[model samples]
Target: MKLEHRIGQLLLIGLPGPQLDLMTRSMLQTIQPGGILLNTHNIEDAQQLVELTATIRSLIEVPPIIAVDQEGGRVDRLKEIYSPMPSADLFRASGDAAVAARMGEIASEALRTLGFNVNFAPVLDIASDDGANNGLKGRYLGSNLAEVVRLAGAYLEGLQHGGVVGVGKHFPGLGDCALHRVVQQDQCSLECGDRRARALPGLRRSLAAPLVAVQEHSHGIIA
Candidate 1:
């Protein structure tokens, strides 16, 4: 591959709409990106999603990674096809790792059937404050570090067991961040240092899904 195409393979981008139309096809052919992360905008219903993903594959020789943020709560992209999934807190509230695993299994089954290979899931951030508007309120899986690790591990295990890759998200623990508010880059280490210990076990549990990120996108991650 050329250097330009090699660089293009590093990107994982979002589409503006559901279908892979002429413009989308052109973009995919040109970029040949490493992956495409599908959001609600890129998914309408099951049948449309299948056709769209199939078209994406047909556009390129090597299949591009297809991903979705189907972590339940506010981020369930497949909610239109599958029933609305409960937020992560509900599983924590249940205090049973099995419940979380079951949910992950069911989710992976659906995502795999819909032509997705990656499920950005099992938010590992600790739920510290309910009042804080960091965009991770309902998305957090545990009230503390241990709960996060155990339940998140169970969930990811289920996701992988069904053959869909599970990407444990927001590494170094993005528990409290605000949207569009850029902080000093130098301070990132200081901020993330405390959470690194907590994040490792979850990483070990879901090692199958390689963790990766880009620019700050949503307030759901930033405080």
Candidate 2:
């Protein structure tokens, strides 16, 4: 492969619109991105989403990483086509591993059918000590390290069962700094030091190298 091709493969870009027009196709062919992220704007309905993803995959030379947030709740990009999923806190509240696993399975099956190989879900971040909304409020499973690990593990289990690669996100937990600061500013670790340290234990327990990379199967291959 050419150097440009290798560099292109490192990118996971979002599309400008739902359909891939001539210009978009040409850009994709040239870039050959490593992945395509599914978002609300790029989605219209079930059939359209399926077609969009399929077309994206076909346009690229190598197998690309088609990813989605798919954390359910307010973050559910598929709410238009599929039922809204409950928040992460709700699952943690139940303290049921099966529930978490089933949520993962539900998300995985849907993504697989839609041509998505990667799901940017199962957030491992523990809620902040201040209990501020901090961007990941609804997304976080819980603050308790043990419960967080347990539920996240169950969620990963569910995702793996459905043959989808579950990507655990926000490593070492990012609840300490406000979401805005983290997004807009650089080195925004305000009051995040002690709390982030506390959160590392849970991440270490769950998302170690072995757990993060589950399968190398052709179906859910990620770059």
Candidate 3:
């Protein structure tokens, strides 16, 4: 690839609508971004989504990483057309690794049918029972380090087995902080030394796994 094209491949961009407009087509034709992140705003239905993704693929030489945040609960992008999925809390509550793995497989197949190759999911954050204020909340796997590790590993395996890439998110943990609703108060900051120290052991355990990748969230390193 040319240097310009190579540089473009490093970028993962977002679209505004259900279809590719002229400007978007031109940009994709020229730059050929490495991936695209689809959100709720860009999806109207299953058919429309498939067409949109197809159009995007046709515009580029190599296939882009078509990603969506399908972590279930409040973060699903395909819920309008697909069946509602149980939150991560449910998986953790079940205490069955097989069930969690099955959920991952089901979610992955659904995404694959819609032309999505990547899912921003299997949130590995460990949140407490009183973590309603935490950014992860119901999306987290579990508070126990051992349970989190086992379930996340199984979930990731299922996702990959079903032909979709699973991305584990919010590294170094997000359980200690609330979701940021505004920027003025710096509520999103991860500067609490104690929280960082407390989270390190779990973070190290998660990093030891060869199957997972760190997601880019709140200054968290993507490994």
For 1-223, candidate 3 gives per-residue lDDT tens digits of: 9988999999889988888889989999999899999998999999999999889999989889999999888787888998898888888889998998888899989999999998888786666554456556678787767778888877887888889988877655565565444432213344543464466556546632344456745542212
Per-residue error for 124 in candidate 1, Å, reads: 0.3
lDDT agreement of model 3 with the native: 0.77
Model 2 stretches with alpha carbons more than 4 Å out:
179-202, 207-210, 213-223
What clash pairs does model 1 have?
177-222, 177-223, 178-222, 178-223
Model 1 lDDT tens row, 90-173? 998898988988988999899889999888787876666655546677888776667777787788778888987777666565
- TM-score of each model, in listed order: 0.83, 0.85, 0.87
* Predictions in order: lDDT: 0.74, 0.75, 0.77
| lDDT score, candidate 2, position 151 | 85
TM for candidate 3 is 0.87
Give the winner by TM-score: 2 or 3: 3
Best by lDDT: 3
Per-residue alpha-carbon lDDT of candidate 2 for residues 1-223, written as tens digits (9 for 90 to 100): 8888899998889999999899999999998999888788998999998899889989999999988888888788889988888889889779898899888888889889888888878777667453664566677787767777788888888887888888776643465545354344213253554555566655656642225632111111111
Per-structure clash totals for the candidates:
4, 0, 0
